[model samples]
Target: MRTVDEIFNEALTLPNASRVLLVEKLVESLDFDEDITHIDEAIQELWIEEAQKRIDEIRSGAVKAIPGEEALAQVRRLLEL
Candidate 1:
């Protein structure tokens, strides 16, 4: 079995989407075992709704749009990806 450090080090080299998937799987493993699946699903749904709302707002000009590159850069900066 891989040590946590080994897994994490390898995870660090993954693409952003892959890293997110890995993290989600790890989080769900811990959370599901503890029976927090409902809470987890609720939070995930909330974020999806929020993101969709933001997209709609942007499309309607209710919110300003950022360049995709700029948004990606900000996410990478925040995540240290």
Candidate 2:
């Protein structure tokens, strides 16, 4: 049988969508509170919609994209103040 660490390492190699699906399924399996599950699902849907909007904006050139390092540097500067 595969160890948990081995399975986790393999899961890390999956594409982002696959990883998200895997995580959702794992979380759902452990979720005992129906109310919390519903809330989590709603939040996930909102995030999915937001992410799609951002991707569309980037593709349409409606907004400029910044490099990751530059964005992180800006966040660090804000936190340091």
Best by TM-score: 2
lDDT of 2 by residue, 1-81 (tens): 999999999998887667777999997888565568777799999999999999999999999999999998886665454
Q: What is the C-alpha RMSD of each candidate to the true structure, in Å?
A: 8.0, 13.4
lDDT of 1 by residue, 1-81 (tens): 999999889888898778888888887777345678789799999999999999999899999988999998899786664
Q: What is the TM-score of each candidate against the true structure?
A: 0.43, 0.55
Candidate 1, number of clashes = 0
Candidate 1 deviation (Cα RMSD): 8.0
Give the clash count for model 2.
0
Collision pairs in model 2: none
Q: What TM-score does structure 1 among the candidates reach?
A: 0.43
Query: What do the candidate models score in CA lDDT, each in turn?
Result: 0.86, 0.86
* Candidate 2 segments exceeding 4 Å error: 1-35
